[model samples]
Target: MEISLNSSSNETTLLADDCWEFIFKIIISDDSCYFKSLSLVSKQFLSITNRLLFSLTISTLTPQPLLPSLFQRFTYLTSLNLTRFHGDLNKLLCQISCFPLNITSLNLSAKFTKSTIPFVGLLSFSKKITTLTSLTYSNIYSIHYTDFIFIADCFPLLEELYLINNLCGSYDNFEVDFSDSFTLYKLRKVRLKRQSINDELLFHLFKNCKHLEEAVILGCDGITDDGIASAISQRPTLKSLSLSDTFGLFSNITTHFIDSLVSLPLTKLILINCCKYSYAGIICLLSKCRQSLQHLNLLNADFLSDQHVVEFSLLLRNLVFINLIGCKMLTESALFALVRNCASLSEIKIEIIWRKSVQNPDSLMGFGVYPQLKSLYFAKSVENPDSLLDFGVYPQLKYLYFANNRWLSDESIIKFASIFHNLQVLDLSNCVRISDEISKLEVLNLSETEVDDETLNVISRNCCGLLQLKLNFCNNITEKGVNRVIENCTQLRKISLQFCDKVHNNVVDSMLNSRPSLRKIIAPHGLDLCDKKKKLFLSQGCILK
Candidate 1:
């Protein structure tokens, strides 16, 4: 590994083998001590070592003392995780991440701590980073749309980009440099997470990114059905669209929108919260995109019935991630019948809480075998003795979420846990029934459950390979559950507790002091508590402005 650094180095004060050992130690142990020791060897050693070590760091724990020492080493990076970075980010932009920002991959999360990267700084970064294929930016503050035009100029060869949860915060108007048309022609996947964009910019992206295979316009409030249809009409290779949480995309005038997708290579559509969509509209959307579609999600807009589901799934023989969570009128045959036809099905989600069927016994009992399924979410399903499916069939099952179910009993959970022997994660949040069986799952998530000390003890005892455990609103839990997690899970990285009312101040301190592996621990949102734990949590990758 150290020999790679010697390729660029002209100096010979530091031996390659000696510097190699320090990084090896840090990778295994995540130890800062080894890194510090290596940096002290010589100026050459310091420069190479810090650049390598800080390439994809959380940046909060990455000391600013190291940046001035290591800023110029940009060639070793492909992915830079700097959203949760500490220190002067805008100034650091002038120093690091951008100046020599010719690296290929960058992930700037929307939850950034500061309003840095003015147009000039971002533009400079884009000029050098021409080899970039994938770009992800989040929490983008009031930077101009023209700023993006500058960045778009750099991504001629770019393929995948995630521009989610950003505010195009500068001037309201944006001008596109159509000087070169095929700027992002090679692009395949694009995710515009929280955008409020106009039709012109949307049109430009669609027209330019003609080769786009999968795109998700998540929460783009400004985009309407007419605008999308018109823009996408020109693109032939477009597929895999997720308009999830896009409430504004719905329209009574659906002719133009429906017509555009009829001959396109469109597949895998998601309409999570289209309030105005009737079953007729859904059927129309499906009739157009059903042939090539393998995955479909229509979460909780409630116009779909068992009849609609049956028709849709028959055409989609390649369906995989089918989620109809909260279609109240859906019968068991709609899912079970569809599962039989969809030989490639892997993940399934529905809205059936802990309550048994008083209205339709046949619908409840009609649920059948999901032999090839891996993950199943009974989103609001209550635990009933007879309403459960045989878990032995789902041998590959990993994650099972039964959140927001209150009628599940202790015995119901034990019986359920007995089924999936290879289960990795299980979420029973809001399952108010007291229980210990769920805690035994490898990675248990009972954030809003009513499990206390005794139940948590079962978790620490049974689930030995557990990596992450969420006890967000489990105020009944004191120290036992936490201690179990700290003692057992050495690979544990994140722990979230947004409204855990029972966690005392000392418990938080002990978690910080004891577990070196704990990278993140979010607590109850109170000003006083936040002030106390601010510095410590910052190192855990939760940056505060």
Candidate 2:
């Protein structure tokens, strides 16, 4: 690659003082590179590019030997993202082993096995850090109860922590005690993802963190009826509460805690997997907390069948967001009943479930009442696409998410296309087959899913006002697919291609050069472009690839 040492005649202050400030602004503010590089020039570009080269979030280079260089140069980094950083936790431990004391937010995730993160090593990191505010260290195998007690001893200022997708086996197996309340007193949000958290520890959270608003204790096996009742009765100020994945919810637990929950005045309630309760449980919930519920996600609580849905339809009149994903027992009539009666319902997600498991998959029951519905998330396993006709003519639909279901075909798109003219966002991400019906769409996402260029071009043409287009992992579309859209769609802003094997360097070059309005391009690590060309393409102001 040639590095031009001389300047051109036409060049008139390509990068001024303002430009450098703007680039630094985006780098510090963490704005997408689309607008950031549009502020830079060709000269001294390589030196300035180093600012982006070491961001723990975007960069992929190994940090073993260069850790000190990163720590010394990027001293102003406010947050470090280590969620998907490659290799073992030892590598991860080494990478941040020298992080600057100023970095406040740290997101540690297991890109590898969770077991690698020994509790002692984690406790040391958490213990020493005094300014850390937001932390996500989740699912490092079965974290012993004593490990948490250690964490509570450390990180006196820790506020937000996500413990989702982890295994906390037999939480009652050990006794964990925090010596001082100073550590937990400042924690605002704690996520207990499906672990069996001891009831006493949870109450400790409620009792200490008087300012706690969000507490996610999904799938906590240690939470008995008494524990749940005690926590809510105690923390009356909680705004967002998630009790998902705790399917052990029986009628007795429901009867015990219904009144207790109603009194807490919760705004967000996620009660997925509470399948052990009767329809009366949901009914009692809606009957008591109808006015305050803003987002209630009750996906796949097996016990509440169509009858309970009917009960909820009558009681829940002010619900704004509801997720009924995997509620197989929810017959079409029940679905119809809720959509029809729940006037304030806006976002509803129904996930893919096993059809053969139900006695009757061909019933035409739940297609009744959706007057105020706007955003819908339809799962991948829905067999009959014709079932969507139950939406009863959606003219106000804005966001449509048809997550890959084997049974979805072009016919379904065509049918739903005519109904949702006001659709602003359409996510046919991973459907089995899409016909010409989608060609009429303006906003589409076939990312990490499947689709032919034929389906893509029609969308680019019909949806001239498209804002964000994602065609990632789609193998069928060649440069022709990209060209078809790039040539026509002027308003397109963002495109994501995480793993489309067919995409080559030439297509990427042309897309970057041809589309002037293109702002962001997110392609996962496999674009077969040369080193020189990749640098040249990025300097032109397109985002990650």
Candidate 3:
């Protein structure tokens, strides 16, 4: 047992090695940069950090021979991400093959076209790494059906596979008869994007991946409703399904498929941009999967109405995240119902696009509080978002995106700000009704709003912890206001002043001189500034664009 002397207490305490290791693991998982920085602090930290930073990511932009030394240094590396590697990917794989036992997860993003690089050569080395369970191969242009089959045969123990971009060969023309000669029985998850996949491929894929629990098929137009239904219906183990940007295949999800979805113990369902999906089919599906559904995202499902949302909310008590972004038919009434009922609801994204049908402010009279609701994105959705101001309390609320709420009056702003003690990110962009009365926040976006110098000053005073401030097109904010923000918000990292024609170079120069925590400045064009100012900004490591 290792013991450490507490400098402050002047007492020796037993240093729990397991606890320290757990903390270091969390730090590594959260951010690799910070974890690497800590390694350079001291020799003691280096040992711990090396252990925690076991997963290494290398890019082709780096020097050619960077791998040999890195592999030697981090022998414990169990995961590797080879991103945008333009160099000989086969050679890189061969190098990795030298120490194949440790790696469990490998991500390869090849720059070479399929004709130039041999998939066989790459997989030859990858196959040596028996521990490899997860593989993500992206942008490996021109991969045929045979190559995909070969990959499965090579990595029999593979559990997770992500084939992104051009990895699936020709989108328009490709043979479907890839025989079910190989089966990845252990395969649990498969993510396919921008692939030319039809019923035949999915039929074989689902048959082989018997234990498939999660499947994400995005931007694959060749996938028809029948193909998707047949594929998923075969995989009874599947609990989560995300089908986004799939050309009208989802538009007409049949009752048979809906029955299949309901029968599966599905906890998550994300349907985005599949505009053809009938409202009735979705509502019916939701009604069937109500008890099991926990996370549901219908982003850009324009057909969904207020009644559908209300009914869905009523049916599902376990829903934690619900995104109805760009659902033009939905209104505040449905959201109110969810808040009043769904006890586990934590995150919600609703767009009240029907401004003409915007409800009266009085409708928010007895709308109950949602104690679990933590994040809300209502940008450009509501015409009258005054109900949010009146909705008594949301103790856990941290992010509020009420942008384009033109009808949200000054009184509402003040009231909302006063109660949102945990509010960190607020986007009041295009909300002309906003006038001062700001909350202590980390991110504040007031773009195209009627925010003047006085409003900026109010934000500077209250939002001392502000990190990113956007004042784009706010002609009223001059040098004085920006200077006040710079001086007050010491933690400021980024400030956008695009199209704010009134703000000249002098204001930007003054801001740079202040030497606050500013990192990026998206200033307006035609500002008269000396080259010295630009040099000074560069010296301070600030991006002035």
By the lDDT metric, which is better: model 1 or model 3? 3
TM-score of each: 0.75, 0.74, 0.78
Please estimate how well model 3 matches the true structure, expressed as its whole-model Cα lDDT: 0.75
Of 2 and 3, the candidate ranking higher by lDDT:
3
lDDT of 2 by residue, 1-545 (tens): 01233366534246665575565555445543432443254545534544443344623465467767766766556577766655555445544644644556777665446453445545555544457777776554456556565666656677887765554433435575755443466778988776656777677667777778888887766667667778777688887887754556433665558777878777788876766656666677767787788888877766656677777767678778878777766545565666777888888776533445455534544545566888766666555557666456777777777766657677777778778877777776666465454634456787655566786678677777776788777887776777788888876768776677776645666676677667677763466556686577556655545
Candidate 1 C-alpha lDDT tens digits along 327-406: 87775556566676777888888764333444544454445566787776665443343455442455566677767767
* Residue 41 of model 2, lDDT score: 45
Superior by lDDT: candidate 1 or candidate 2 = 2
Q: Candidate 2 clash total?
A: 15
Clashes of each: 14, 15, 2
What does candidate 3's lDDT look like per residue over 41-81, in tens digits? 45556666666666777777667577677777777888888
Residue 390, candidate 1: Cα error in Å is 3.9
**lDDT of model 1, residue 361:** 40
Error of 2 at 107 (Å): 0.9
Which residue pairs clash within candidate 3? 251-276, 251-277
Q: Give the higher-TM-score candidate: 1 or 3.
A: 3
